[model samples]
Structures are given as structure tokens and as C-alpha cells.
Target chain A: MTATAFAFAPGDIVRVKDDWPERRGPAHIRTPYYVRGVQGQIVRHLGDFPNPEDLAFGRPAEPRPLYHVRFKKGVIWAEDRADDALLVEIFGHWLEKP
Target chain B: MNILDTPSDRLLAAVRDLLAQKGIATTAEIQERIAITDRASPGQGARMVAKAWVDPAYRARLLDDGAKAAEELGIPMRGMPPLGVLENTPDTHNLVVCTLCSCYPRGVLGYPPFWYKSAAFRARAVRDPRGMLAEEWKTVIPDDIRLTVVDSTADYRWMVLPMRPDGTDGWSEEQLAAIVREGDMIGVTVPTIG
Candidate 1:
């Protein structure tokens, strides 16, 4: 399947979407709660793939962009040391300009 | 069959039988698949790491594309998620975890350890990696070095390229591979001369 164009480039700071399935948790979601609504810098484009959220339901999924995001220390956890960072892979649909 | 089979074992039997009834895969075929997975070991990833240490060009290829590099070394990477290599240096350290689930580089390093899939490890690895390393594996990240936690919670799985330990200057590729361990590649422990 053809991949959708990348929305954010490397080094761009993007925020994760806070929206999640209300009430009970959804069956599948790649977006973790820790990074939800948090801002991180784009490290690289991890290539496009079918959305796992849709693939879990056996739906026809179009390929979408996924990016490697780097979050600094104290952003996710307060006990983290200075200059320490966290890196995560977040799909494009969950990211936006911060 | 053992009467002590857990619910998970019963669930597997049911699925296997159903699949066989539907002609999806025979019992023998499923057994072969299980054997293939079982045959996979940390030695495969160790071989790649040792070769990378000896060959700079191969190291570049490995950092560029982990799956292709493993394929170059005769390791099949078909039907696995994209593999990413997080490098460790003197100034920077990298640790891998799956906050959501155990999204591991199983094709290369075989199955993940029990601690990797534990809820406690997942949470602590993200919130207090420095402490987690120090306590669980006794691998302390010094203050001089920067600690970077990587979450393999998505499709892209990861493995660490641990720094070559000191006092192993003239070691051969095979010798280097011997010092590499499963935890070393997982960033839970560093390779020691022992």
C-alpha cells in the first residue's frame, strides 16, 4: 500500500493527541498514555504502515506515517536526571504542531 | 496431555485444533513453527554485534538497517516488525522497554525475558531507568553519561548496541561474541569479561 505523506519532519516538535476511547479502554492503541498530550521532538520517520488500531479490527487500513519522537527528562518523569531523554514511536495521527 | 495444563495451554490447544479443522495449518506444521521459534537464541544477535564491532562497514550497515544486516549474516528477518538499533557510547546510554506491551526484537534476540513483560519493569523503566538499571541488573548509569529510555510500544522494535567492554582490545569476532549476553543487548546489563 502507498504510504501517506509525512506531516512533520525530523527535529520538529509535535504533541501527542490526548483523545482516547472513553469509558473502557479500546482493544488496540499504539499511543501510550504517558506521551498522550505531551510534546516531543521528531527524531526520524519510521516509515509508513497500516494503522494497528484499525488492523486489530480486520479493517482495510491505509498506510500512515509513524515517527520516532524524543522526549527530554522531567517531561515524562520528575525523577529523571538532567539531559536524560525518552524516545518513542508515535503515529502521525497522534501528533500535531506543539 | 498433562492434567496440570494451565488455561493458556488449553486455549492454545483449542486454537490449534480449530485451525487444523479449518485446514489453516496441520498439527505437524504448527509444531514445526514452534520448533523454529524455539531454535532462535540470543546467540544470533550476539553474532551480529560481535561482527559489527570487528567490521566498521558492517556496523554502519547494521545501524542503517538492522533487518538487512541480520539477513546479511544469514538470519531470516521475514514477517517481523521493523528492527531499530539504539547505539550506546561513552557519553550516552540507551535502554529499551515496552510500556504498552512486550514489543521486542524477538526475531533477532529471541523471546524477551519475563521481567521485560512485567508491569513493574515497564513502568519503572520509563519513570526511573537509572534506578531500575541499578537495582534489577545492578547496572548503574553514571552521572556523566546521559540515559535515554526507548519505548518499543509501537510497531518499531529495538535492540541496544552495547559499548565494547574495556580490556578486550585484540579480541576476535568470536571472542567478542562470547562476552555478549542477552541482557547486554537489552541494556539491562553491560558485557563483562566474565
Candidate 2:
């Protein structure tokens, strides 16, 4: 399969190898609010989940690769955190090999 | 009046009634959900972040027509009228604060973080976004990057879509989705590469 054809299945965690120069902050749709800026341990992965961007266009595809990312509450929430354990789900590309 | 439930209050009641009927959640659970769901339209701007991630073309469209674009994305932008997605570029970082009230994009994301609505955050986010972010979220934005603090209120709602991270190549959409966090989407957090 071509690069575009590479399927992102839920429950699988992979790394983002390139930087999108035009990206906004860590956006939320499939990603968790707490996982931003915190290195994630991929706990879930998926294949071809409907692109959230597509869902916004009223066209969400089948469930794609969704990963339950675990982050140290201290990492994501930092000083404001009340605990050390906070796990959240994010899509696959949001990760990079730690 | 506290005697009469607000729209969200009524919605919470309905949710409680449904939960009670289903025997899944307790009265406490219902109350928790209601309490957490105080923000009227947190999801409004989340739709833009979600959309921008999927379709580059659509992302462009969202910048042009945030409201109509949300409708196109199957997100109900009803009570929350206009939601805008502020792109966080390399040179600029965007932060959101509700100086007036806890106005946010509930229609798109779901709810506001308890701290986002706090008086302390409101005061600091406006007067000193860099300091507030560093002290609260632990995100130290470089001084070179322009920081724009947007107000979240009944009149206007805003969300930030931080620049996509580096090192994602030919990854599936789900893979891309993995790093997107609600805070990052709101400019409060940045996706970290592990």
C-alpha cells in the first residue's frame, strides 16, 4: 500500500517522524487535552479510524487507530496537577518513539 | 432562578433521569457530570481542530467559514454561535482566557478545564500569558513567538490549533490523532514527542 494507504488502526501507537510546519497547538478531537506536551506511552492503537477532520466535515470514517495514551499528570498538567496518574486517548501520529 | 433549571441544568436533569432509568449512574454521578459540563460550548472550537487535522483543504475552509465549516463537520454549532480556530504558527502561540466569564467552545470540545475558568487564570492569562502558562501548565513558550490571548465569553469563543509536531511521516490519521490533546488544541498544552 502507498503511504496514504497505510492504515491507522486503533490500539496501536506509532511515532510522528516529521514536523508539520503549519500546525496549530496540539488540537483536540481524538487527542486528549492532558496529553499535550507530555510524552505518551501508547496503550491503544487502531487502523483507519475516521479522520476527525473529516468528521468535522460531516464525514467521519470507520474507527481508526485510537490509542489510550498514558501521561504523568505532572507532565501534562504540571504544577497545577493534583495527582500523578492521568491517562488519555490520542490518535497514533501524535506519538513519536520516546 | 436556582428554583428553575437553566438549559444545561435541565439537560443535566434529563441525563440523570436517563441514567436512573438505565440504572447505570448514581445521583452523584449525574451531579458530577453536570458540574463538569458547566461550559456551554467547549466543543465549538474543537470541531475546527479536529477538522484541520484531517483535511488540509477543509482546514483552509474552516479559517474562512468557521460556523458553516462546523456544520459541514457534523458538529452542532447551535447555542454557541460563532467559533473561530486560531492557528498557532511557529512564530506565534495563542492562549485562551475568559476574563469576563468562562465562555468556551463547549459545542466542539465538551467542557472547560476547571482552571481555565478560574479567576486567577483569567487575571494572569490576560495580564501575563507567558507567566500563567509557565506557572500553571508548565508550558514555557519562547519569547520570540507572539502570544495572543483570546477571551472566551458568550459573545466570542476561540480555540487554538497548535502547529503539528515534527517526525510524523506517512502515519495514519489515527496516528496523527494520538498526539492531539484538548489542552493543546486550546493552546494550554503542546503535544510532546516521546
Candidate 3:
């Protein structure tokens, strides 16, 4: 199946989608908890790939653009002394223009 | 012995047995895949890095297409995730981590170090990378240099192409490869001239 095209590009500021339904029990989720709702900048366009969330359940994945999202150290941690950066691979579906 | 098996290990063995029973994959094929993993090591990565240091065209290729560049060196990359080579420079340093799971470039760098797969490293590498670098790995980055941590959470796996150490101008590719540690490729430390 053709993958859904992504609108956002590298250098775009984005916020993680925080609307996932609350898990009833332990589930195989790829999105990290700390990044949900956090704002970050897209560092690179990682091209299209199968959505890993569906792949975990042995289902066919609809491909989506994955991006390397960069969050400043201080943004993630309040007490961080350095202004270093962290890049997380996030699927297009989990991000929105902020 | 059963107590020693982790849940994942037991699950893998069960899956393998079932697959074998159904004639989906022969035991030899399973063993061969395991052997391919075993044969992979840091030496394979070091050779690529060393070659890049000497050959500008090859370096460009390495950065442009990591898996194809590896194939130029006869590295088997089939069934592995796409590889991304991040270049380290005087102004920028690169570190790689997998926040969601232990996704790594096993085709080139062999098995990851124990810490690379740890919960603590996964979290801290993205949260406070500079602190983790100094306190845990003993590698210090100058304040002027920008540190970019690449998270290998998707289909593309990443490895750092570290800056060649100074004073190694006359060194052979083999000699250069010797000093390029697995940690250096992982970006926890820089390759130093010794």
C-alpha cells in the first residue's frame, strides 16, 4: 500500500501528540512517555518507513515519514547545565505543528 | 538452566522451534543468521572509518549512502536496517542512542556494549547527554562544540564517523583502524592518537 505523505519537513517545530488512548494494560508502544506533548524541532527528514506501532502487532504497517526531532537539554530537564541537544526518531503521525 | 532464560530468550527459542516445525526456516538458516551476527565486529566499522579518512570520494559516499558504502568494502548488509553515518567535525560532535529499543548497526559494529542497551543510558543520553558523556564515559566535549545525539528508533540505524585524530597523518589505514575503538564509533569517546 502507498504510504501517506507527511506535511512537516526538517527544521519544523512540532509538538508530540498526547491523545493516545490510555493503555488498559501493558502494551507494545514505541513512543516514549517523556516526549509526549513536548515540543521539539525536526533535525532531519528520515524518509518514509512502515509504522512500527502496527508492525509490533504483526499487522501490515502503513508507511509514514519519520523525523529526527531535536529537543534541547534544558527543554527536557530543568536542571541541565549544558545546552546540548537530543534527537529522537518520531513518526509523522505523532507530531503536529506547534 | 530454565531459570537462567529470560522471557525474551524463551520466547525466541519457542518461536524458532515452531518455525522449524512448520518448515518455514531450517535450523541451519537460523544458525547461519546467528553466525553472521557473531562475525560482525568493530573491526569492520574501523576499516570504513579509516578508508574515509584517506579517501574524500569514499567519505562522501559513506555519508550519502552508508549501506552501499559498506558494501563497497564487502560488508554483508542484507536483512539489516538501513545505516546512517553521522560525521563528527571540529564544530560538531555526534552521539547515537536508541530511546525506544536497542536498535543498533549490528551489521557493522557487531553487538552493542552493555551500557548502550541499558535503561539508564537510553534515558540519559537524550535528557542530559553532556553529563552522561563526562561522568559515565569520561569523554569531555568543549563548550564551543555542538553535541547532536542521534536516536536510532526507526528503520535507519546510525554510527558516528569520528574525526581522525591529529598526528596520524602518515599512518596507514590499518594503523588508523587500530585506534578507532567501538566506543568512538558509538560517540561515547573520541579516537585518540596513542
Reproduced native contacts, each prediction: 0.95, 0.00, 0.82
> Which ranking of candidates, highest DockQ first?
1, 3, 2
Model 1, span B34-114: residue lDDT tens: 775687789999999999898999999999999999889988787678888888999999889999889889888888889
Rank candidates by lDDT, best first. Answer: 1, 3, 2
Which structure is stronger by lDDT: 2 or 3?
3
For residues B61-122, write the lDDT of model 2, one tens digit per residue: 87665666777867656545466667888877777766656777665677777887788987
Candidate 2 — number of clashing residue pairs?
77
> What do the candidate models score in CA lDDT, each in turn?
0.87, 0.59, 0.86
> Judged by DockQ, which candidate is best?
1
Which whole-number lDDT from 0 to 100 does residue B46 have in model 3?
Answer: 98
| Model 1 steric clash pairs | none
lDDT of 3 by residue, B1-194 (tens): 57556698788898899999999997898898899899999999999999999999999999998999999999988878889999999989999999887998999999988899999998888877888999998999888999988877778899999999889998999999999999999999999985
Q: How well does candidate 3 score on lDDT at residue A38? A: 88
What are the TM-scores, per candidate, against the unseen true structure?
0.90, 0.51, 0.88
All models, DockQ values? 0.85, 0.02, 0.69
| Per-candidate chain B TM | 0.87, 0.73, 0.90
Give model 2's docking category: incorrect
**Cα miss at B106, model 1 (Å)?**
1.0
B112 in model 3: Cα distance from truth in Å? 1.3
